[model samples]
Target: MAEPTLHIGRKISKVRELKGMKQETLASELGISQQAVSKIEQSADVDGEALEKIAKILGLSSEAIKNFSEEAVFNIIGNTYHDNSASLNYQCSFNPIDKIVDLYNEKVALLERLLQAEKEKNELIKSK
Candidate 1:
């Protein structure tokens, strides 16, 4: 059998897809062509620095992308679900795009609240 680490490109491709990011989008972020991204995805290895940049764009750590694989996923699920006392209660109802949008909105709202508080503090000082 081939070494598990030999499939890093495929792992990157899978995680990119899961993030709802097209190879073209990734290519744009990486300053490479879509064809180049496709080629990298088909290869067994990618450059270390480039991989780190790609992982950041995908909102994942480089190690997460490197270690992600079907076998690993299966192992995690198997271990988590097999314990008789454990319960799997959550469901995935929305697409990844919706999830991302929701996260973005949450961050924006938090930032707006912080900005308002800062403005209030400034006004209080100015009134003194």
Candidate 2:
């Protein structure tokens, strides 16, 4: 069986491939080594900055990476619940839709921050 983390790595790699980007090209754009890019695409643990850079390099909004990670975690939890049904009881007291709404709100907040930062940077450059 494949590890859940590996599944997420594969998903990231798939997205990069869909964008028609090579790992070497992305690494160069991000100022990181190709090996580092490979590690991230493979779902190895990475820092927040690397995640942000990878998203940017892949022509994705940071929110997309955030949402992808959250969805991957949700899938792992769901799969574990089903697989461990014999050993544990899973109760759903909250609606999954509510969680989705919350996540969407979080994504919105992140995008707003990014937008604000860009605006500030632009203003600074104009003032100079």
Candidate 3:
């Protein structure tokens, strides 16, 4: 079996895609070239400044990128330790993207409700 990769690039790419941002757009925002963005997303050892720029552009913290990985914990442990010491396993049920979407939707619903209430109040005042 092969070693698990950190997949920092994949995380960056995923965040960018979720935000509907193109590589060229991110590069332009960071004053870099499209190729630089591409390389950053593909390489695990990208420059710290570049990674910070990517995180800011994607509205994600650096810690988020640090924890990004495609491989499961079991796979990671198996690859790192075969028949050796004890291993730990963990599972994540919540997705960050889903949580973000839910929050945004909730905010929008609240705003709509407030607007409706305000409009009704205005109409009542006008009729008085």
Candidate 4:
């Protein structure tokens, strides 16, 4: 049976896709071939050292990639947008849509900060 833990390779692939990056780009960053990146993404497990390298290339922490969850993402979006207090009042043709875009941009920035803090904590723990 599978351990039900996060598959590191799959998470890597997901992040790469969300960032609009191709396997070849990741390979170039890692100084490996596209085929190598594809092979790496096939395995369920990646070495911790290699994972760290991949994380650096992907602009994420190794721990973040290992612990990434889609539910948490949806939860964030739901929490941010589901608040009626923050809801936009649409009186114009484009204002409401622009407000939606603003909300998403704000949420993405907030998430980035949180991710950076998590990375710092992980680094601190590693140094301890």
Most accurate candidate by TM-score:
4
TM-score of 2: 0.43
Q: Tens digits of per-residue lDDT for model 4 on 1-47?
A: 34535677888998889778999999999999999999988778999
In model 3, the runs with Cα more than 4 Å from the true position are 1-5, 69-128
Q: Model 4: how far is 122 from its true place, Å?
A: 75
- lDDT tens string, model 1, 6-122? 677888888888778999999999999999999988878889998899889999898889878777877877877865454566455679899999999999999999999999999
**Model 1 misplaced stretches (Cα beyond 4 Å):** 1-5, 74-128
lDDT of 3 by residue, 102-127 (tens): 99999999999999999999999999
Candidate 2: clashing residue pairs, number: 0
> Alpha carbon lDDT of residue 94, candidate 1?
73
How high is the lDDT of residue 23 in model 2?
85
lDDT of all predictions, in order shown?
A: 0.86, 0.74, 0.79, 0.87
Question: lDDT tens digits, residues 4-113, model 2?
Answer: 64464565676677678888988899887989778877764546776677777777865575456546756877877766545557666799999999999999999999
Clashing pairs in 1: none
Error of 3 at 128 (Å): 50
Residue 43 alpha-carbon offset, candidate 1, angstroms: 1.3
Give the higher-lDDT candidate: 3 or 4: 4
Where does candidate 2 have its weakest 10-residue lDDT segment?
A: 3-12
Ranking by TM-score: 4, 1, 3, 2
Model 4 clashes, total count: 0
Pairs of residues clashing in candidate 2: none
